[model samples]
Target: MSKNLADLNSLEERISALEKIAENFKKRAAEIDEKGEFVYENIADLKNCGYTVLTIPKVFGGKETSLYDYIRLQEVIAQGDGATALSIGWHMGVVRNMYENKWNPKVLAAVYEDLHAGALINAAATEPQTGSPTRGGKPQTKAEKIGDKWVINGHKSFTTMSVVLDYFVVSASIKDSEEIGNFLIRKEKKGIRIEETWDSIALKGTGSHDVYFENVEVEQEDYVETLGGAKRVNPWLLHIPACYLGIAGAAQKEAVLFAKNYAPNSITGTISELPSVRTKIGELELKMLQAKYFLYSVSKKWDETKEEERELLLPQLSAAKLVVTNTAIEVVDLAMRIVGARSLSAKSPLQRYYRDVRAGLHNPPMDDMTIGQLANFSLNKY
Candidate 1:
């Protein structure tokens, strides 16, 4: 193994240990509603397991796992539980932005220290009117430069892990500059407030909420540029797809087991013996298989490339997210169908999978928008 891969492997033992503990919380996960009311010791256990800091570059004393390892880690953990994986997804995503932008030495060091200290980080990018960055295709929050710091005032909704996260990478427009920038808002900052508004139909434990920033203050150095200027082609955004694929694969596995055990009201045999159930299960497996390969291939493509070859890979990576997320939703829906009315219950694993995976469709550069962009690029050639 390379030095980086070797370093990242150490995290698996710790995280896997935490997953074993979190297994006890699976049934209780749906009961915890609202953002602040949903805290589990298992999440804290993740900190104890050395999970909150793996993304920092080596200069900052972080393992800086390659995209291949990072996504792989997410997939394994996600298969065990979806909400935990969804909550941690943002932390990994922002740390990736840090890598892409090539943060200043001090910035990297500070974030690394924060992570090691058990601080959870997340991205607060979606607003009520702005739709989602994944959908609207751009940022709507505003960052005003005043004095030595930028004062950010906006409302971001659906911010995952809002309760536990110590830092938020907020997407806001530059006040007078008419430009977009991401401001790192500390949870401890004076003007920032979190509204416990994330009561959803699924992924109830993710703690996604509405965050209100009534002039949150940050130094110029704290801002991470994601769009418009000096942006790095972060292949790390690929982590989002990893989260969805994990849920899909888990659901696919669950559906098979349920079919083997389920007894229909009229039929004397297990559902697995039914021809219809077998057909749907086959379809779900095929989609999951395709999705898994697409995700791994894209990550490996970049990992094997020179710095000069990355631009050539972005279109393919974007296509991977579009396909994998869509496939996951389809595959999980098929699982729900196999279970029938029982799957609609609050207790069924398929219900959460059904709702949580839809977040992928609404996730940044929305699928419709992505298709449009892809078509534009491809059609212009003909």
Candidate 2:
């Protein structure tokens, strides 16, 4: 094992290691975006650095990083490459949720072992028919019980990290029942295939391909949890905004650097000295500061709050995601304005950041749902 991988025992060590690798990620960011190719090397680097297992419980031989630290780590990774950060964030968030919410222990153990062995995982929930799962649409995917095995047949869309995931917790409707369940399907299972269907302009390297399960069989025990179970708050979803915030941070850096160096004949000095440029930079800083405080504060509160009290935090959690994600988009826009037309150049990182940050809007807990929830809560409370 590499020395960096061995030293990932604490949050600080992991952060340091991620920072070291992010420079290399930045160098390849444009190429990955241009080709819309998944950077397998970036994923490998994350695994080699032990970041892939950061959310697993300590008893499972993992880092058990706190929610706050996990968000911080994600932000740092996003600074280098938003696509890589977003792709990996799904794995991290899913793992954290499983452990926190207590998924099937046996399955969790088996998956943790795979994670230690450089395997990745993510939920395959969204489907072409259901649209965003957040809208409470029943999955079109169907699972049938055949003897001791359950045969799953369905197509899952937006399966992030599809190319590399070792396991997919697929949501499917149980045949002959009104029930929906998440089945833990291994990648090596027979009758499983991935269709390279992802072609989004934003976060193009996420490799969120379409996965088909035709007569895929799993042990009944692999049926992990029922869908639409009592809703429990998930603070880990904040990783979504954390990823975008990191992209915005990268954009902010690019803008600052460009302003400090690019001297136009019309200016006495570099534009960094211009009041207008300074104002935009200041606005960028303000937005980022607000976003960081909101994200980190909520994550910290989640870490400190009791499990039973966590349900009450749903509104705040959704608000944090909403505020931070929108703030990140605004920050990137301001950053591009600071850099002028050159920011849109295919060679410029700002263009990539601009495109990547927009993906956060489409992530879980949609803006409309969050707003409606907040309104409901306010009306009831008052």
How much lDDT does candidate 2 score?
0.89
Per-residue lDDT for 311-344 in model 1, tens only? 7676677888899889999988899888889888
Residue-by-residue lDDT tens digits, candidate 2, 1-382: 2445445566677678789898889888888888989878899888877788778888788777889998999999899988888889889988877777678788888888988888889999999999998888999999999999999999999999999989999999999999999899999999999999999999888899999999999998899888787877778888899999999899889999999999999979999999999999999999999999999999999899998798888999999999999999999999999999999898888888888899899998999999998999999898
Best by TM-score: 2
Q: In model 1, what are the clashing residue pairs, if there are any?
A: 134-363, 134-364, 134-365, 134-366, 141-172, 141-173
Please provide TM-scores, in order, for all candidate models, with all chains considered together.
Answer: 0.86, 0.97
Model 1, C-alpha of 314: deviation from truth (Å): 1.8
Can you list the residue pairs that collide in candidate 2?
none
Cα RMSDs, all models: 3.7, 1.5
Question: Which prediction has the highest lDDT against the true structure?
Answer: 2
**Residue 67, candidate 2: how far off, in angstroms?**
0.5
